[model samples]
Target chain A: MRYDIRFSGSGGQGIITAGILLAQAAAIKAGKNAVQSQSYGPEARGGASKAEVIISDDEINYPKIISPDIVISLTQEAYNKYAVDLKDEAVIIVDNTLVHEYKQDGHKVYAVPITASVKELLGSAVSANIATLGVVNEICKIMEHQWLLDVVISNFPERAAENNTKAYNLGIDLAKKVME
Target chain B: MEKKRERKFLQGNDAVALGALYAGCKFYAGYPITPSTEVAERLAAWLPKNGGRFIQMEDEISAMAAVIGASLAGKKSLTATSGPGMSLKLENLGYGYMAEVPCVVLNVMRGGPSTGTPTGPGQADIMQARWGTHGDHPCIALTPSTVYEQFSQTVRAFNLAEKYRMPVIILSDEIIGHMREAIEVPLEGELEVIEREKPACAIDEYKPYDNSVLVPKMASFGQGYRYHVTGLNHDEYGFPTNSAKLIGLQEERLIKKVEENYDDIVQVEHFMCEDAEHIIFAFGSSARASKDAVLNLRKKGVKAGLLKPLTIWPFPDREISEYASKVKDITVVELSVGQSVREVSRAAGGRCNIKHIYKVDSKPISPVDIEKAVEG
Candidate 1:
């Protein structure tokens, strides 16, 4: 099975880091083939930035996503840009607090208050990328939950670890509640 | 006993730095550019920790000069840059060629003629890599299609440079340079690392440009064997010689060394070509998509195959000609407007029909793109 996932947001939002962490969980932790790549404008921040990950049981030949099976959009601009042209059954997880407008288009759309909830619970929305990963895993089950958690913890410093963990768990809970 | 290897998720640029370290690279001098900057970044942090030297030169020209200088000083040296920086380093790159300074110059290509797209991919540098420095000099360039090859081929690039005593180029695109994948980095002693041969003769008998042998033994500056290194045509004694015969001989030896060693220096990958009637000629990132297209074509019973040249410069003319003799058609796929297609036409020698799929919009050619071109 192959899963093509794209994370889109403004620069400095850690969208690229989220995609990398997902790929790391698949390749290093789950022992599967994975490739992660990103593209951003010249601007260091505020530009539309995107990171893509392809996870596969077989060897992945084409590194880029031909048609995304899953997309996580943290901004309305990103949503408007990437959330279209996806597979008919593609799953989309958008930050409801930030992405105010989106087209459902028969695809599974989980509009969760990702950034707002993280800010309310952890006093900062910096961990919203990690929370998005949690929501993605809950919806897609691309890898084991523990594998992703381990990979996420390894990426953060000791001080930020607890908050990121809380954000991740909060994402899973948000996805669970939305699915219900 | 088999050596233990470590597996980790590595970006292509990071892998190149690690491969250089594994191959005993001790010095890095480069002006960082997009797509290739990670290579310099990794080497900058790692080289000092490993008793090596790293310098962020004022510009690309100085960076190339510093690498040549470091290599002449008996250190395995390297520098990485993208298209624009590569253009700046060409003059010194030519100097390295004329002076026979062994160093690795990596060009992680981006869309270009003049800063076309700083963060996008392009293969237009294939020809630039061959003729970018000018003159009738021979070139050695390696193109890696995957992150693993980025590591292994970088080690090979250093090996080829040290063994051949020339400036070897690694032609990577933005995709391969930045893409991250899992790779098993070779343990030390697993991969053969070639160090330049030291002079075996007495100090008095030493000639830095000794043409008696295919490759002369090099002595470091401080090692007491003094010699003149210049871009000018020089005689066997390393001094500028106006003698026509000496200049002719000097040029002949430089070209002949690589030409005679073509078998050893050239590397190409042939996939499902045994009975293929149509072949896709590609390299670097385009080869990845072509491989997928070939597999997809095979499933549909189309006789499509892929010829990926790992060694881009010595241009696998002989191999392509052999395939062209039997193939009905050859389609050259690249991410540039059109670069490798010219080489493909020359190599095919009109034995078969040649088609090309070129994309210069700073976007990669997808597998679907290749499949559509082939199926149509």
Candidate 2:
């Protein structure tokens, strides 16, 4: 079975990196076949950026994701951009701080205070992407929470590891509360 | 022997770069273009560590020229470009054909004729790829629909370039270019690399274009076979000749080299066409959409299948003809209006009913459109 997921946000929101992390986690760590792709306009920063990930047990025959099963939006602009494309039963997780309102319709919507959670823990907005990953990890339940923490730490350099770890654990805590 | 690690996530462009490096590509010349720039960037960072060189040319023309020049200097060379860049490189592509240089050109095609949609995906370069360059020179073009095929076609492109002493174009569209997938790349020693076959004769007996085989035993520029080379019509001694006999002979040899290798050059993939009544013909990125459409058609109880041309050039006439004789109706879908449908009609020998589904506004031809075409 193919599990297609999409992350959409402005360019600086690290949407592409999040997609890469999913592909790496699924293909490398979890040993499943996965494909990831990203799209953005010419604007170097602050433009709309989207990253798509498809995970399957066998080969990925079709590369494009026509309709996504899971959607994540960190900004209101992103939520407005892809809210209409989600399937009726698709799960959507939106950032509460940046995204004020969630589209309450056929989709199962979950609002997580991603940026607020990270800002409260690290006192910075730069780690909101890490917090979003915490939400994804709990929602998907495909990989271990510690494994994602380890992935973030191992993938990042040594000096940034400690702050990233704190930000990641904060995400895990937030996600656990949401899931419970 | 034991099996190594199975699969790892790799960006499609990264796979092409790693595959080129593994195939002994030492020289890379390219101008950065979207969907294909990552290939140049990766090679720029990786080639240096492997004792190779990477040059970002001023334009696509120079990129193509530099790769041809480096290959003549006995270095395995390559260049990457997108749609507009590929158009600019067509001039040098003709030069490579006339001069018979062995090199690989990777065209990660995005939408368009004039910088149409840089970030979008389309496979509208099929006809341009086969007839892009000027003149009647022969060419080999390989189309890879999947990322796995991207890795293998890269190695195959280099191999064919070295084997036939011609430029091979790896035509990949934006969908497969930017997509990331799991690929099991072979370690350095596990892959068998094919280098160019040099002349067996001594310097005194060396003739650049002899009447031996269609492709003469080429000697590298600095390898002591110091021979005359020109794009103009020339004799076996490589000297400029105005004689009709020499020009005719050179042209014939150039065409014959690729013509005789048709059996080895033509590649196609046939889907459930054994007992099918209708056929959908497509290639490159559009082939994936056709595959989806075919699956949906079968579910609806319509006997449909797909015919994907892996080698766009030397169009698969035999397969098309045989399938046409069997199937009652055929539909051709493409990003362009009527470029490939003409060839499909000719290949079918007009034995079956033919329909065209053209989407030329730089958008992908969806399966919904295909199903509509079939019903209409």
Off by over 4 Å in 1: B1-3
Pick by DockQ: which candidate is best?
1
Write the residue-wise lDDT of candidate 1 on B208-265 in tens digits.
8888888888888798888899999998878999999989888999999899999999
Measured as a fraction from 0 to 1, the native contacts recovered by model 2 come to 0.56
Clashing residue pairs, candidate 2? none
RMSD over all Cα atoms, model 1? 1.1
- Could you give the interface RMSD of candidate 1 in angstroms? 0.7
At residue A110, candidate 1 shows an lDDT of 87
Cα lDDT of model 2 overall? 0.83
Model 2 chain A — which ten-residue stretch has the worst lDDT?
Answer: A58-67
> Residue-wise lDDT of candidate 1 within A38-129, one digit each (tens)?
98887889988899999999999888888899999999998888776688889999998989888766899889999999999988889999
Q: How much does candidate 2 score in TM-score?
A: 0.95
The CA-based lDDT of model 1 is what? Answer: 0.91
